[model samples]
Target: MIQAFVEGGWAMWPLLVFGMVTIGAAGRFAHRPQLAQLRFIGAMSLLTFVTTFHATWLAISAVLSYLSKLEDVASDQLVKILFTGLMESTRAGGLGGLLLIVTLLLVAIGTLRLTPKQG
Candidate 1:
């Protein structure tokens, strides 16, 4: 959400840039017939996974906070609750992201193996 991005501060800027670069790299590699393209694509995919994981964590934290009835709670208490939720979401998102990256790398490797070698 927009709110989450805004609240994510300066850290979000790099994530945005990473996402854009990843898209560009993917697009470029998709059209190229070189086997070496997979290395760049794989690296970009890893970066993309990192950004995606963080964004997911922030979104999850925002949604959890919004759903919880913390409106009347003290500021300190609210911060604590949000922090706890963020920590939990970070762990979950990190593992999910790692799994995704691994799967992507495996698929890329499989594709590379299937493609006929060029002289």
Candidate 2:
């Protein structure tokens, strides 16, 4: 995994940093709920999703590479399996990341909406 990231070049570094910051911000938000921190958490969650784009692409590529070599595999079967695996992986990571971002945004918005304006 480290080797893969190293080979992934400049893009991976920001991804790693974003992932770490997201994890840290999430942890802090869990420990303390404050409207001021919500924006940071939401931003970090979005950044994490962006950072993970490569993983999703790689998953699709892997599915394609594996299915391409299998002469016996039917087209429909291949498409079905590919989409199934892609959805599973995406839920585990891609969609899950988006869900986190949405959840954070909603929470932040709700909090702001409920808070009384200060004069």
Candidate 3:
């Protein structure tokens, strides 16, 4: 779990940075509360899903492996061999999602935080 978080965070950092810069650019071009708020909400939801899904996938494999180990089926052997493959895919997807969310969240907050004073 900790490992998942760490790797996810690391892999996500770059993309998040990119998003911050990118969204900042978008805001410069089409700054609007509606759009910024929407971007922020979308990002938070996406990151939440990415982290949750990665954790769930890991949990599933653990349960499946345990069951297979008990039954002495090929699932155990296959599971061990396929560990890297699954982890790689999950990490890639989860990190990308996480980064996008983080980026969007930053943008949303910035929009609200830096709003101009109303006349």
Candidate 4:
């Protein structure tokens, strides 16, 4: 988990904070359902989605920049480098996706709890 965060670079920090706040709010909503908390969770999820892609793009750009500087690099080595960079880049997206899923589940539970028992 810590390794992933380090490989994910700066983008992961904001996402970490967003995820924590969102999960906390969602959990709170579940305990005491509130419209405001639901809205906050929704907004945080959206932000998380955007940041995930943004981090990926940054990583890709870095990889491209690094590749551009190379001269006469072997195909096998180039492929290895590309693969490694792409894999590292995906860490941010993976974390964001996990956070989104958890937040959504919490929101759903909160919604279910918020609604009165239909008779």
Note the Cα lDDT for every prediction shown: 0.58, 0.60, 0.52, 0.84
* Clash count of each predicted structure: 0, 0, 0, 0
Better of 1 and 2 by lDDT: 2
- Model 4, span 5-113: residue lDDT tens: 8998898888888888888888888788877676778887788888888888887888888988998999999999999988998998889889888888888898888
In terms of lDDT, which candidate is strongest?
A: 4
- The per-prediction CA RMSD against the true structure, in angstroms, equals 7.3, 7.1, 8.2, 2.5
TM per candidate comes to: 0.47, 0.47, 0.36, 0.90
Candidate 4 clash pair list: none
Which digits, one per residue and each the tens of the lDDT, describe model 1 over residues 1-119?
Answer: 45545554444666666655655555554444456766776786777776666666666757585748556888888788777656544543443354455545554554555547631
Candidate 2: residue 1 lDDT (0-100): 41
Against the correct fold, how does model 3 do in TM-score?
0.36
Candidate 4 root-mean-square deviation in Å = 2.5
Per-residue error for 101 in candidate 1, Å, reads 9.9
Position 97, candidate 2: lDDT:
58
Candidate 3 residue 15 C-alpha distance from true site, Å: 6.7
Tens-digit lDDT string for candidate 2 (30-54)? 5555667667877877767765776
Model 2 weakest lDDT span, ten residues long: 88-97
